[model samples]
Target: MDVVKYLQRAGYTTVQKSFYAKIAEWESWYIGNVRKFHRYRIYNGKSYVSCRRLGMGMAKKLSEDIADLLLNEKVQITIQDSSTHEFVTQVLNDNNFWVMGNDYQERKAYTGTVAYIPYLDAVRVSENGEIVDGGTVRINYVSAEDIYPLSWSNGYISECAFVFYKTVETKLYAQIQIHKLQNDQYVIENHVVECTNGAGREVPSEKWKDLKDFSGLSEWVETGASERQFVVDRLNIVNNYSKDNPMGIAIFANSIDILQGLDTIYDSYINEFVLGKKRIFVAPELLYTDPLGNPAFDPNDVTFYQLPEDTLKDGGKPITEIDMNLRADAHEKGINDNLNFLSVKCGFGQNHYRFDNGSVQTATQIISENSDMFRALKKHEIVLQSVLEELIRIIARLGQKMNIPTDPDSKMVIDFDDSIIEDKQAERSTDRTDMSMGILRHEEYRAKWYGETLEEARKNLPEQNQVIE
Candidate 1:
């Protein structure tokens, strides 16, 4: 089969197109220089045309700033049961979920949508013809367009397909997984196709594999897994701005106009510096004449022009150098204004970014707690917290299905560390003052100050009292 035919038979053409569009948006922001800068043609009444442009990568800068601010560090994951905690911790460490979660959040910021797929690896049947643990649970992430939910209801995906590409020995292959409900069973169909030059041939493989169905599972009844193996993360949605679908908006989408204006102004400034304000002017009489008696000068000629006093008497002016900083101040102001607009539009608040003295610096003098910047951070954190909790639940359900000794009903807690930007010592002092006034407990103080949980803080309470004594 041809690759085109494979795609046609694969179905969900509209979904694939939407996914590519979302990918293009992400690439435009992350890869940089996707949006070409406009070059201005400078005509100084001369035959020479000077083309100049200054392309500042605003999309890349804004997206990276927000990603770093939101997910620079690993999030804290806590489980309720001690045994379940150990199992969950081991599973997360084995799968590197901390790093994956950080990347997922960042991808959400850039692509506006992302997903977590929890799947069993190396599954096999036992000698008794029963499903048993054969491998560790694994979790992977996918961007928005690559995942297509066939049906959605009450915030749950009933059926879906995930399309991805793989390379084996320089040959490209398309791997499609369709997860659906069949006979009250959770079935997944894996299809592999060799794609070359818009043609595809389906690679032969086993058809359908059944996962543990929740209808008869005790873990599903106790825990709220819903037998889901996939979770879709939609971020920064403003009217589903991309298409009629749930394609989310990019973080820096609103700042594009300001960025373009900045680029235009910067390009004009460079051109003015090179051709408009700074130039070499020489008297036409001082230049050598051509065969047609036309006044001409060789730009490459190193010969010096000998201007005599008699030339001045004949109304000839000597060679003069012209240099002026035209619109230099305006250009600086315009660039800074655009940077501020871009920062605020991306939820960094005003004055969060500043370009001064030929360098960029974030404002360090102001307290962000009372500003809109902190509010924006909190808003993003709320979404991230929920996403992480759902991801943990999916992982716990996988453990349960594997028959691993784990607590399926264990809840996860996410602790975000925002003290890097704010004055954490000041917060600690306030907590201390509250504790001294009998409004706060020593355990609560330890949890807030040392980034420990209430359990961990309680364990340290006796040691703290002994040290104080």
Candidate 2:
């Protein structure tokens, strides 16, 4: 296949690269390599103050908060069919799906992820006692940069291209899964994909065609969507981050640049403050000045200045110490302003983070109905609920493919513990009051308390009614 032409037809190379760049920046910030991403400027003949400053870690912290708030505790998932429920439960346990969800959540927070079913071999014995092929179900997670949405309508992706690399024969080979419509039906066509090397040649290994698995019948099932076995998780999308793009921005994308700027300014202030505080001018006669005529002293040594009797004639000491305290106040104020701006822009709300006494501190957690942070968490919770629901459907589809009779329409209940956002006991007290007053049904009250959906709570409602009657 013409890899270049195919990529051109898909027209996501630019978008993919752009997303890759953002991922790179987010990754750098996550791991504390932020200085290079937002380098500090040097001016006024001042050498670049190469001070190692602590990174903001805003992306890392925010992503971690998302995972912890959404999936740190047990995620309540309910399926109707007993057999399918057990099967999916085992699959999730074996795959550590909840733990994997944390990693996936981090990915979604950064650049989004694609969940797809990959074909695998399931072992079966033939009647003649020979081992034979049985289709296996496996869910594979791919990153946004690797999975490109080729076509879309009404904000839904119709076609996609998943490009990845495999090492075969000690050489890197490009592999692509093009999930597109064939004969007016969705089909996944595997290709030995290649891209232009430095020489601009469509270079593919001789083993590329041999590696293609063309034997099995295509796994085809209508998902009521254009794609057969893939779902895109777009979290916190931003516009104009790049040219007309399909990829969603990271959760903290809006504030990363600001955070970067803040990091630089904070570091610069620190370096300047440290230098000023340590600045000791020893009667220019005791120290040497550099070409810039700035007093230079050996930082590694303690210098002693000898004072002549004449120097103290007017009670003026030979040593002059400059107190930069007032100047540092301005820097401190600027740093505080930026930190508050970052906190608010990143959805943590104003004063969530505070700069105090040369260190940063987070404001105490407030569990109040009127709290902005609680509202922010609720907004994100809504999006997270939808994402988890979609993921459960994908897993259920995999279960069906594995011959575990799963009802695709089976309801899934995702109970996120809102205790972190508000006072759970107080809320429960209010719920109990409402229940006693007949303002809320017993099933609804129980569902809220037990973290169950109304339908799941109804299974036990009959017994309670019988006892009460």
- As for candidate 2, its clashing pairs are none
Residue-by-residue lDDT tens digits, candidate 1, 1-469: 2322344576633343545555675556455444444444556787757454566666666666666666656456667567767877887788877677667666767677778787666665443323555477777678765666666654446667776776655667666766666556565656776666645666554321221211121111111233556777766446344444544557765555776787777666667666654555665556768889765777565443445546666776667665665777777888799888877777777887776765567776644543777887788777667766777777777777777667666654567777655787787788889989989988788766665667766777876452232
Clashes of 1: 5
Task: Give the 10-residue window scoring lowest on summed lDDT in candidate 1.
Answer: 213-222
Per-residue alpha-carbon lDDT of model 2 for 305-385, expressed as tens digits?
444545546667668666565466777788789888877776677786777887778666654533666776677677677
In model 2, the runs with Cα more than 4 Å from the true position are: 1-6, 9-37, 40-55, 112-136, 166-170, 183-185, 193-227, 242-244, 277-329, 367-371, 462-469
